[model samples]
Target: SKFGTIYFWRVHYNDSSDHVNETFSFRPVQPGGGGGGMGGA
Candidate 1:
């Protein structure tokens, strides 16, 4: 990922009793610019 660039991700899970799915997004930050970038669910 590049600085200031937006990235997306998806998560999925399955079990005998349930199924789960989710989507998430976040932006990249510059190195040593602090912690991880902002994200949304």
Candidate 2:
């Protein structure tokens, strides 16, 4: 996967029935973006 590139994914399962999950998309952030941090609660 390339950084800053949009990616798409989905889940599928079958248990005596066929089903499809909602499609989702996300973009990869650059290294050391500094956006992930645990704030004081």
Candidate 3:
């Protein structure tokens, strides 16, 4: 796991009435390197 490395991940959660699952990919960034507040999202 290095800087700016992209990885695939899974997220499981409940949406109101039913169960939900999601898959996404995101890049890692250095702390305070760019815009703040959930920069990878």
Candidate 4:
């Protein structure tokens, strides 16, 4: 990864439920930058 680079990531829940629901999220990070989209500016 280099500066100015961008990336994406997400997570899912695989469970057996009558109303199975899951949420996916991603936080891109600037190459050489710290922290994910969690609180990136």
Q: Give RMSD to native, each candidate.
A: 8.9, 10.9, 8.9, 8.9
Clashing pairs counted in every model: 0, 0, 0, 0
**Which lDDT values do the candidates have, in the order given?**
0.27, 0.22, 0.29, 0.30
lDDT by residue for model 1 over 1-41, one digit each (tens)? 32333322221222222233222212123232223442321
Candidate 2 — worst ten consecutive residues by lDDT sum? 32-41
Best by lDDT: 4
Model 1 error, position 41 (Å): 10
lDDT of 3 by residue, 14-39 (tens): 22222332222222332322334334
Clashing residue pairs in candidate 1 (N, C-alpha, C atoms within 3 angstroms): none
Candidates ranked by TM-score: 4, 1, 3, 2
- lDDT by residue for model 4 over 1-41, one digit each (tens)? 42322322222223223222321122234333344432442
lDDT of 4 at 19: 29
Which of 1 and 4 is the better model by TM-score? 4
What number of backbone clashes does candidate 3 have, counting pairs of residues 3 or more apart or in separate chains? Answer: 0
In model 2, which residue pairs have backbone atoms overlapping below 3 Å? none
TM-score of candidate 1 relative to the true fold:
0.13
On residues 1-41, what C-alpha lDDT tens digit does candidate 2 reach at each position?
32222212222122223322221212223222222321110
